[model samples]
Target: MLGIKNWINLNSSSVFFKGTRIATDAYGKDLLVSLYRKYINGYPKFFKMDPLSRLGFVACELLFNSEKVETLQTDNLNEDSCLILFNKSASLANDKIYNETIDNENYFPSPSVFVYTLPNIVTGEIAIKNKIYGETSFYVIDELDATTIFNVVSSSMSDTNNNRCICGWLECSNEDNFNAILLMIDKTSDTLFNIENLRNILNYK
Candidate 1:
């Protein structure tokens, strides 16, 4: 049975649910594509996603589908919630790729590549897939600050309209270096989704 953990981490080619290493591949790209095909098939648009979006998408899949017992979610339930994501690298990795295409000699600007230049694209993708209709926000900071994350979560929860959230960090500086940590937190939640609590529960090494 799949274990339940507070956090999901995708580093390189390995995937951990609540720190338990359950899946691995030869490379990070292989891992993302494999997971997508396995659980999120028929979504051909997935191929157009940048590294960061792919990283977040896969991590959300693991966290949302990991445990048998239900927690926070959407779709058939049609819950209204916000998806707040934080990252330092933003879309620099994909931006670099898009830059190459716009070079003087290359000059091959692809709409698919251009669309992913926005850092918030990952949030949009997840919101669409998960049926999140509330505010979807993405912040770029110098680093991941648990205090800041908590503050944002608290602020979001303070709104009666937004009673729940899927918040965390998704960073991908390159195709090989990527990480995603997502939490499904509700205003009246039992388990606190703080970074420390999640870190303690995470079994990924």
Candidate 2:
């Protein structure tokens, strides 16, 4: 069975891990910045990431550093771990930002905004931060389809023979609406990792 060792979800409301809400008063972007300052003050590059990348980066930090996972050393060293993320908006938020920079009236394209137009860039950010050498891919679908996500993740894990995988739904449609469901999964026959659980987490408050 593919069991979930640790999981986290964050939205405009709050953040949760292991079914317990993390103690915090901050919300939205402020919440992310707070988490970074509390746990990742040394990573200066995190300040320069796009909104989506920043969201995913913080989620990874919270998920991996938790006590549920003991393979931290091998988790970073092995090449079998994979990252598979699903998003409803494929960098549309950043695309709109970049488009504004080159509008008919402005006619100026900022390269900085242009760099984050790819949805996979968030996955790249996570992989780079964790040194994951295995497959890392991002899918843009109409919504958080649990069946599709389960199929892709199971297939990828099998193909890579990965003992551990970072799979979840991550999306930032805009400033007002953003969501992240990050999970650390391992192939152990303890906790369940099925479609129903995926849907529950994706729809969690």
Candidate 3:
């Protein structure tokens, strides 16, 4: 069998993404307060679920956008495209918190809280929303670095089955703070964006 196609570097072409809902507004103001002023009952989605779920929701919203959908479904790569995700915070934080509610000796493990115990569930949710059947994986590490991110992304694309790839770094802590960065990549681009620059672009460094 032929060797897997070399992975395309992220900076070689333009990447598209949608939705980046941070705790602060675009103007660097409090987002929750801003939502309250514009609504009568206040925004419930942000406060109702764990911060990780909220981040996953935003990721789903981005991947499910009309433009992204068109690109994902219509565009064809050389069979070296895949999906890679890097995450720092594990789902255990939320699980740990929710387990406290029932672990007080009276209740058993609550299914509601037990569901978010797996970090990869977030990636699975995004795939379901976008209908993406490509290679999917989630990496949990202590920190996000250029080498680690580049290696995993390269490995995913190194497979002959992948023609293009979408790679990202996602992090969410129980403190209601979360951030995600996504990149869409393919071969055949004249431009080149190095890993270091890509990391800088995503503020990962």
Quick one: best lDDT, which candidate?
2
Error of 1 at 18 (Å): 1.7
lDDT of 2 by residue, 1-205 (tens): 7887778987766889977998876878788888899877788988888888888898888898775344644554547788899999989888988888988988998777799999999888888877788778899889888899988888777774576788999899875468989888888746688888777877777
Off by over 4 Å in 3: 1-49, 63-68, 73-81, 106-108, 188-193
Q: Write the per-residue lDDT of candidate 3 for residues 99-121, one digit (tens) a residue.
A: 78786686777776677778877
Clash pairs, candidate 2, are none
lDDT of 1 by residue, 51-167 (tens): 998888887777777753253453544355677888899999999999999999889999989999999999899888777778899998898777777677667667767666667
Between candidates 1 and 2, the one scoring higher on lDDT is 2
Model 2 misses residue 70 by how many Å?
A: 5.5
How many clashes does each candidate structure show, in the order listed? 2, 0, 9
Arrange candidates, best lDDT first: 2, 1, 3
The alpha-carbon lDDT assigned to residue 18 of candidate 1 equals 56
* Candidate 1 wrongly placed segments (more than 4 Å): 1-5, 68-79, 194-205
Clashes of 3: 9
> Which RMSD does model 1 reach against the true structure?
3.9
Per-residue lDDT value at 103 in model 2: 81
